[model samples]
Target: MPTQILKEQLAISIRMLERANHIDFNGHMSTRVPETDFILINSAAVSRSTITADDVIMIDLEGNVIEGNGRPPNELPLHTQIYKRRKDVQSIAHTHPRWSTMFTIANIPLRPVVMQGAVLGEIPVFPKSQSISQQEIAEDLAEKLAGHHIILLKAHGAVVTGTTIEEAFVRSVFLEENAYRQYMASQLEYAHSLEDEDIQKTKNVVWQPNNIRKIWDYHFSKL
Candidate 1:
């Protein structure tokens, strides 16, 4: 809601994801500044676990640093272009989670297998392997992400969007958790996805703003 608070949340979410093994040295998170054209995001060079509010920097929609002393993330357009296209997305998370990335290489599709998995439904995989450092590449990624809250990079990582950073972070958590279960299920002889009727039961239950806040609070408490 406030710039100071967004910085703190970004720092906390980055640390949370880093510890959860969702993000490594390569991942980042960003949020839109209300009533402004600027976005606040974690710096590229900072260690994910030790970042502070001060390490979060402000950049224009075009990826130019407007404040703070930290260097911009090379995949900055990953956040900038999405913010430009998806006017509904207020936050984004780029996570290279192990289980999720594993699915990118295999033929299996991520599905709503677990209880909370219904929240993510079926995550799409974007067919790009290169780094999203340039304008055109990021634009393509954004196009691939149209109308979806989460999309996995071809052989790299996953991107999640939300109306708030908490939603994005929680979805990142769900993405990995769902992918982990999906992978585990694959190890068995056979597995089945939740039926459309089953998913319908939980979709509204999990996607509610209050429920998202509850999940975020649970993770934030762990942080």
Candidate 2:
């Protein structure tokens, strides 16, 4: 994809995340500059909802700003280190949704109770509560991420990775949605989760390109 298009998509995804209440003032999103070590991410001071294509900054794998104005996110290492460690991840989203953050702080496990939750069989929770600003902490977080696409930052937020902006954005949204349902279910006397077979049956279909595109379109329309 073109760099201009990627910037636009990134901005749209940020706005959509804010609209869905996945991020407030303290969230960041980024995408790899196709075939390059550089990434386009939101500025540190910009609110997710107010981000525009012009507000996105391009930085190298070493965290050096290559283009655009303003400071990159303070958690720049969080995105850069993941790009260095995971060759498959093309986009990433770091946000602090209420329910997901609640689960993170409470140290509660997230179960695949909903169909969408199936994609996240067992979301890992990073035990550290400090900011992942340093290179070493970011690398440690990436190690905890292992082969998973999403991970919870204890008392901080959550991070979701994908091969595309739509994939990351959709997964982030669903992760929060699942957390919301889980919180509500906890209020009841009992709650059951989907069986492994059921989750396996729907996993492929739910993440298919057409389905992801549908979700992307729906959310993008809302922006």
Candidate 3:
């Protein structure tokens, strides 16, 4: 029953991300199997919008499929490396959202442009434009992602990590939203970021369990 629920949550997260345009055909999401070295992720061929629990596969840290028949994503190392590095991170969302990707190639730093962005603080850029297909590259990316919730891959995309699937999914959405707003604001004048005090105060209220649940529930309902 627990595994079934996890699969459902994975499916819902994929659908929500696709609907929000955080990902299309190229992105992926995964969750570490509780108390296990396995991860459940969407299969390579599965489109985010049409993915079901059956489309999800279980794989080991080495990117070897442990269960399910579908092939894992080529960027499987990205998920495995983060899980190996951050034990507290239970879920991950690796996407190529337009605005976030734009910021990466535009050489603009993603800062706290609004209350939602405050929860994320300063986002880091991975400084690499290539796909993270090698173990070494994945490790380097993970190192850059250390102590950060979101990291932008130069000309690639962004990766969001959280202690829960909902948190990771919500962070992915907000990352894109923040980037979109910042991009728009840049057109008018130099956009200012929230001060540290404002970020801390807003994060205290916005990142609470109840608030995360509210956003998670609302997005899941759309799936």
Candidate 4:
């Protein structure tokens, strides 16, 4: 797909995710080209459900607006920081997913409750600096997201990265599902959690992009 079309679809998906309750007013999403520093990201204050394709703003790696008219999300630094830190990533989706936020508030590093919940590696939690300044947040997130694709913001939300917007969205959706399920099971008193071996097996199986592509295509195609 052409870059322009992909940008539009990404924006539309952001809106759909928000409308479908995968996101709320407080979160943000971003996508970028493989070789360039330019990125497409959601703006601030606009309800994600009402955002149009044109509403997606473009910015340089340094967070300067290069296209579109709207103000970028306050978390723009978070997006650019990820792009700079991980060259393999082309998209980053941040959301205040209800369940993930619950774990975040409790300072819980999510354990693998099921096959999909397993983080192949450790998912880190950043201190609640909540710095609105570009320099501060970028440096903080870089330090926080050292070894994984998913990172929880203490008392805030989670950030997910992928090679594409669809990939990021699907991962974000499942992460929230895992978080919620774990929370519900915790309440059940006798809910059985995955064994260490099972967790490792699931981690190995689900960590690859190749493993998730068909699933990503199936759902993203519907949009």
Q: Model 2, range 51-140, lDDT digits (tens) per residue?
A: 899999999988888999998888889998999999999999998888888987787788887888988757889998888899999999
Best by TM-score: 2
Residue 56 local lDDT, model 1? 97
- Write model 4 residue lDDT over 91-111, tens digit each, in one string: 888877778777778876687
- Clash pairs, candidate 2, are none
Winner by TM-score between candidate 4 and candidate 3:
3
| TM-score against truth, every candidate | 0.96, 0.97, 0.96, 0.86
Supply the global lDDT for candidate 1: 0.88
Which 10 consecutive positions of candidate 3 have the poorest summed lDDT? Answer: 1-10
Model 1 clashes, total count? 0
Give the 10-residue window scoring lowest on summed lDDT in candidate 1: 183-192
Index of the highest-lDDT prediction: 2
lDDT of 1 by residue, 1-223 (tens): 8899999999999999998999888799999999999999988889998999999999999878999987889999899999999999999999898988988888577888887788885577888788999999999999989989999997899999888888898899888888888888778965578888989888887788898788778877887
RMSD of each: 1.2, 1.0, 1.2, 2.6
Model 2 alpha-carbon drift over 4 Å, by segment? none
In angstroms, the error of model 3 at 170 is: 0.5
User: What lDDT does the true structure give each of the candidates?
Assistant: 0.88, 0.90, 0.89, 0.76
